[model samples]
Target: MQNVTIVICNYNYGRFLAKAIDSALEQDYPATQVLVIDDGSTDGSREIIESYGGRVKALYKQNGGQVSAYNDAVNMLETEFVILLDSDDLLYGHAVSNVMRVFESGNFVKVQFRLDVIDPAGKPSGTYVPHSAAPSDCGSPLRQGWLYPSPPASGNAYRTSALKKIFPVPEADINRYGADFYAIYGVALLGAVATIPESLGAYRVHRTENSGIDFANSESNDKAPKALTKRWAILRQMARARLGIELPLSFHDFSLEKAHFCSAVYQAPFTKRWRWVSRQSHSYFRSIVGNPFWSYKKKIGTLALSSLCLLPFSALSDFAVRYIANPLARRRF
Candidate 1:
């Protein structure tokens, strides 16, 4: 059997830590190794990690954020394949086995699967992430500057060799919160990414402030677009340096374009909000038309939805902000 490791990174999530660890330990695959990295949690998270004792290998470090934890884990892991599980999420019993099977079947650098969304109480929210299925081969779309569907960190399993080529990513604040963006995009440049259409894990949604689950949080709304833009630029630079692949400077994803539109609508000065909204709306329209992977039906539907951006700031725009533009809101229902 091939060896696989699940690295669970945690900060102050003591309330939800045990369940995440148990999920890793209970995987049906015998060769699975569970490693938990506690990034200086002050909320009794240390005791919970210590209780695992011999079953898991634990590393305790100061709070250097998520990228730091990933950096530390990659430096020490010798497993052939690796999965990074957030401290608040979970892996199904067969997740490791399924991922290993796919890895054995092809020369893929990454394997991505769907995630069921659950509320804080562990109740099903009747939703799954990515909203759209990922394509088996992403190179064509990627070359066209289109970002194919992908889930958050916990939903991906990567080849350790490919990860080593991409890791030790710059420990900046942007990367600290969005390491998965670098991992997913970076590895895609190295080789193909396999897609498993079924749900293999659970992603918990809650109002943890920094979790970015609450749509009403103005700070999160304001920072999301700017952060996404920065991450894209960083990935472009990393691809050139690490893989010698020069990606296009322009990129488009409908969901992210919508985010920029909503942010401009709410954050721009009152006197200039319309101009910002119009610019973002045009960008959103271009993304819909240019996307090669989307069907005509999907493109038409999204175009109709994008039309709502033209309305002035009122009840209709408010509706667009909540239902049409907010990714979290769209994911929830």
Candidate 2:
């Protein structure tokens, strides 16, 4: 295995933080090192982190959210690959070795693996996300379309070179609010990603766990939409300034896309909803058309809806989407 740095960021998770550190320390990879950042936890986190002595390096700072902690970690890491872990989660013993086995000479910006859901007591929840195996090298982003439903942060491994290309991410709302969106999505846009087919980690579901970007968490419900908007805006800005690629998508543009896909936006305030769909319909129409991942039949249906975006038939379109399109498509969020 290559020289890798496992970065575990912690807040008030003192009880579970030790297991997370132990998991990183116990990695069988010969060249692996552990760095733990205690993000200004009021709890006894410092004592526990200090207890590790020289086995793990520790960085202590005020609680500035995950983005701040992540940015700090990246700035300090000189390793080839960085694996992020959460304080409340546990990494399988072979996670690092398995991910490194697939790291060949390629343009893979990152490697992500699935996580098994576990309760507070660490019992299995019997649910696996993405529900599909992608063990082989995925040359491009999973699909050519939009980067929706990004993989979880802790289970992924990213190359340092790839991250430097997208560093100093604009600390907009999403960067401050969502933990992994800025890095994950930015890296995905930069190059291809490889997904390990096996489950390499456990995501602890509990009330006290710092629910960074989880929408199901009670605190994250309201922050999700605003965070998503900020993420889209930053992507557009980066594409223009750094990559010189004029993006076909943006915050408002995605609003139109989501409306078409979910149909539930019709229930939103009329002027706000109408303004977005009307302005972005043309862009949305073209964006979804040439995407091979989208079926010709679905394209035809969306195109038809786009044609009527400016009209007063949004209520009907919304009805079709909320009642018919989503049910028929069976897309999981």
Q: Highest lDDT: which candidate?
A: 1
Clashes by residue pair, model 2: none
Q: What TM-score against the true fold does each predicted structure earn?
A: 0.88, 0.71
Cα lDDT of model 1 by residue, 28-90, tens digit: 999999999999999999999899899999999999887789889888898979999999999
Expressed as tens digits, the lDDT of each residue in 1-333 for candidate 2 is 469999998999998998999889888888899999888999999999899899999999987878788878888888989888888888888988888886765658788888876767887766644443342323233223255433467878998887776666665434764557667766766677787777888877664222121213223434445666666667667766876655555433233344343432344455655666666446555656654334678667766754443455655545544432222122223
Global lDDT scores for all candidate models? 0.79, 0.66
Question: How many clashes show up per model?
Answer: 0, 0
Q: What is the lDDT, from 0 to 100, of the residue 247 in candidate 1? A: 80
- Candidate 2 scores a C-alpha RMSD against the true structure in Å of 6.8
lDDT of 2: 0.66
User: What TM-score does candidate 2 get on C-alpha atoms?
Assistant: 0.71
